[model samples]
Target: MSITLKLAWKSLLNRKTTALLTILTVAISVILLMGVERIRTQAKSSFANTISGTDLIVGGRSGQVNLLLYSVFRIGNATNNIDWKSFEEFSNHRSVDWAIPISLGDSHRGFRVMGTNHSYFEHYQYGQKQHLSLAKGEEFDGLFETVIGSDVAKSLGYDIGTEIIIAHGISDVGFSRHENTPFKVVGILAPTGTPVDKTVHVSLEAIEAIHVGWESGANLGNEPSKEQLLQMDFQPKQITAMLIGLKSKIQTFALQRQINTYKQEPLSAILPGVALHELWGMMSVAETALLIVSVFVVVAGLMGMLSSLLTSLQERRREMAILRAMGARPRHVFTLLVSEATVLTSIGIICGIGGMYAMLAIAAPIITANYGINIALSGITSHEWMLLGFVQLAGVIIGFFPALRAYRQSLSDGMTIRI
Candidate 1:
């Protein structure tokens, strides 16, 4: 056995260049396959963590996914607003522990601005039920003050005390600017790897105060003075949505059912977990497609290994004859070939995982900045272990054809070529 391994190792070293190239090909493919799986799993986890500790998300009558997209992710505009009276009703319900109202439909420099009260910072949670905390300065206090998310502060170069103008509508450009009522950045939130990192938060009263004179989507003459608007009522008549937390986990469904059947207005109440699952369900098709592409890439890499082994067999014909003459059985030659492939594959797998960790460490910040997806630097998952096992198995299976060819050729060319 030792002699066979020594012979196999020397033969691979004899063709070191091709062997190294084949190993690298497999390494790159393994990196890609592992990366895709990692991203898929982490993306789902991040998505699920976006809204935790909240039992139900209440909003104006709409699809569950739609409400989750706009309310939690701030992706789109709400089709309608829930009446403020209704918000008060359910918020004060017996089963509800707390409610955080969310007012949408505003933007600043492409980042969505959210209107909520202090309960948002107190109740809203993410990434392991973690509460929102200010990285610098303090929460917004006055009507014209705002709190910026970590991504907003970093991307736009804004810090605490930087004044910003809010746009009337949600657009990157070509929207009416609310220049008359600029907000001071009073706080900057820590990075949460969730939607919170991309939002600009302010008081609900601030949302109402800014649009004081713009009742009909047009400024009614000049907008009100800061003092004048402050003197006027700042109570919001309607809100886009609310995040609800219950005192008891068992009452979550009953409260959600009550909110859904509220007669005061057309409303929808969706469990955050259920809604998140639905969103992932819609995205499963794309995830499957990515996995399939990665699998094919790995197959192509293994095929490259097979081709190299087959090509090297022709050059090793005399070597195989020498082995046969020395009493090395055909099965030994077969095992030798398989062992070489296994060694190459084992080395390739190690290099692939190493490369994956290095690339993730480098690209994590960029992905978080551009796509808001956080890829964790954690150990391999069970699914990934299975994938690696399958790849190793595939390498052995690919080696079979080459080993069989060598076995048959050695029998025919015993001591010398039959031709």
Candidate 2:
């Protein structure tokens, strides 16, 4: 084995450039395949952890997907608002532990505006049931005071006491400005890796206060002036969605039934976990497609390695015959070729893993800022290690046939030059 290894090292050194290039090719392909798998797994985990401890999401009747998108992800606007009457009824239910009413539809420079009560800060949890923490200052204290999420604060460079105006609607453009009732950023919450990190939260009344003004841009002869609007009593009669945490999880189904059967307006209550599962079920197809593409890339890289090694064997025939004349067995010749391939592939796998970590380190901030996806660079998972083992085994197996062919040629040539 040692003699085979020694000859392998010498032979690979003779073709150092080709061997190294093949290694790099295989390494890069392995990196891409593994990186995609890691991102997919971690992304799903991150999504699942976005909302924790909330038993159900109660909102106006809409598609289940829409409810998940707007309520948990803050991705799109809610079609309709749940009446305050319905919110009250749900909150007062015997099975309810706490209800957090979330009113959306306003924005501050592209950041969604969320109107909720203090119960939001007190009851809402995320990422392994962790409570929201204040990064700076305190929670919103008055109607016009606002608490910013971590990403909002970071992106907008907001600090305590920064005054911000809420736009009248969701559109980044063509929205009435709330220049009259700008709110002060009184707090900044720590990162939660959830949609909450992208929201600007305030009391429900604040959302109503900002919209109290001229109608249809005609000033509505009855329109309230800026000062009058400021002094006007304001209360929100509706909210986008309500997150409910029941006193007992067992009562979840019963409460959902009650909400769905409400006599007045149509309403729906969905379990957060179940809804997330459905969302993932929809996403799995895309994930599988990506996985398939990555597998193809890996196979292509392996085939390239095989082709390169086979092409080099002819040129190395004379060198192999010389070694055979020096008392090397045909089996040793085979072992030497196989060992070189194995070593090259192993190096590629290691380099690929290193490359993945380096990329994650550099791209994490941008990814978090743009996609709100947090990817951690840590030791590879057991599954990934297993994958590496399989790749190495495949490299050896695939190289075996070429190695055997080279050995047979060297044996036939004996001590004479094949060329």
Candidate 3:
């Protein structure tokens, strides 16, 4: 066995340039394959964990997908607003534990602005039921005070006490830029790799405060000063959505039914877990397509290796003939060829794993900061192990092609061949 390995090792070193190139091709393909796998698994986990510990997400009557997108992802506009009365009714219900109302339709330099009570900071949870923690300062206490996410703070270079003027709509050049009631950044939340990292959080009153005196999507009356707006009524009459936490899991369905059938207002209550699963399910097709592409890429890399082995076989015929002259049997030639393939593949897999870790080390933080997906620098998962196993098995299987060809060649043919 050692002799065979030594022969294979020296043989590969004979065509060191080709061997190196083959290994690189395999390494790149492995990196891509493992990267897609990592992103797929981590993305699903990231989505599922975006909001946790909350039982249900309540919003105006709309599709479950719509509510999830607008309320949680801040992706689109709300279909309509839910009356504050309805929020109070369900929030005060016997089975309800906590409710955090959400108000949108405002932006600060292109960042979505969210409005909620202090309960948001207390009750809202993320991955593994982790609560949002302040990285720099405390939650907003005043109407004009705001708590920015990590991305927002870093992107806009905002720190505590940094004043920001919000626009009326989602656009940077919105309907009305509230120049009078500029909000001061009070807190900066640590990066959670979720939508919270991209949001600007303020009190519900602050949402109302900036829009005071606005009518028909424009300021029809004189705008109130920041001080005056703070003192006056800022109580929200309607909200875009709310996150609900039930006292007991048993009553979740009952409460959902009750809210859906509410006569006062049409509303939709969706279990966050169920909705999240459905959301991820909708994206599965794309994920599967990406995975297929990666698999093909790996196949291409293996095919390249096969081509290298076959081409090298043509050039190494004389070498094989010499070995046979030295009493090395055809079986020995076969073993050596197979061992060469195995060694090349083993080295490639090693380099691929090393490349993968290096990539994760460099990209994890960037991905977390931009997309809010905290890809952990973890070890190979079971699925990745399966992928690696497939690669190893394929390599050994591919070895047979070259090994068999060399085994069948007669010593006379190999030695007499001049070309």
Candidate 4:
């Protein structure tokens, strides 16, 4: 190593405690910045790809956000039910190609139960318009048959032929149980990293048949025997929402307008893409706030480095005088100060990146299970590379202030030790 760079290295070693702390500060700041960026991107990806290949989500008259919350995310109670006749009219509309009616209101354990026909397994899509695939068995084909999700199977220890009782309402507890008509787990869907992974699926007939004796949120009248239920045909009286795929992209808006202005009932039809955009729009402010906080943390870390360097200058004045006596120019002293910063920053960046990936590797499964958002340990994107570059550049620029102080000290204190 050159004399100046060698001197810079040994100098940091001399004040190892301060230097180590500064490096740690920088590393922590980097971790927070990278974490925020990763979660933000993954959240958007999960929400956008939650449901796809559907042109519109039709529901009882409600705001787009409300419909999206209950229909797509399964986050809240059912807003309102669309009449079965209304669903039929729209499902058979000239512009519609297929429809998947969603009947939600029951929960098994802590997970939701969704009721739909086989069209759901056939037409429903998620993540790049990928169709839902069965991990085991086949779709529900009978009144007492049901399908489950990967997470449900893993959490509840359910597999093919495992019987599960559906609850009356969405709560995990205190709801009426449909014990008389237990649904057999006939199918299990592969994980999709969406809300579907947390749901149990049953046929629409199953939904109606289970409610045969249910009235006013409680069991009423005599429950029919399983054989009697199987002998009867079931038709859903209402559905919470329906996902529609249009015959052509050009007809999406035309049908949406028609659905919104239906004469029989007030309804809302939302383009999933538009609702997703609006959802993100409402959430952007918080994202920006988090980004701002991350930026400030980085600034505080850099400021801490600057503070450490400035304090070290007082003790190094005599050292600078000796360097001048050894024929070292003022520029050499400046170069030494700046090189120390470059070394500390480069090492901190490396440490920060390594630590971030380690945390992600550990937390990936927990995040996927709880949030249904898959965290991919992919290589750093170009944007992150640029962010790191900016951090390094700022570190280098921070060196100039300390270097300037050292440069002046070397020139004026030449051969004259100051105590």
Residue 27 lDDT in candidate 2: 88
Clash totals for all models, in order? 0, 0, 1, 0
Colliding pairs, model 1: none
Q: Give one digit per residue, the lDDT tens place, for model 4 in 174-263.
A: 448887788899999998999999999998878888888878678876889888998998889999999999899999988989999999
Mark the regions of model 1 whose C-alpha exceeds 4 Å error after superposition. Answer: 172-175, 411-419
Which should have the higher TM-score, number 1 or number 3? 3
State in Å the error of residue 360, model 3. 2.6
Cα lDDT for residue 417, candidate 1? 61
C-alpha RMSD by candidate, in order: 1.7, 1.9, 1.3, 1.6
Per-residue lDDT tens digits for candidate 1, residues 228-293, read: 876776789889999999999999988888888888788999999999999999999999999999
Write the residue-wise lDDT of candidate 3 on 198-232 in tens digits: 99999998887787789756887688887787678
TM-score of 3: 0.97
Error of 1 at 59 (Å): 0.6
Note the Cα lDDT for every prediction shown.
0.90, 0.85, 0.90, 0.89
Winning candidate number (TM-score): 3
Off by over 4 Å in 3: none
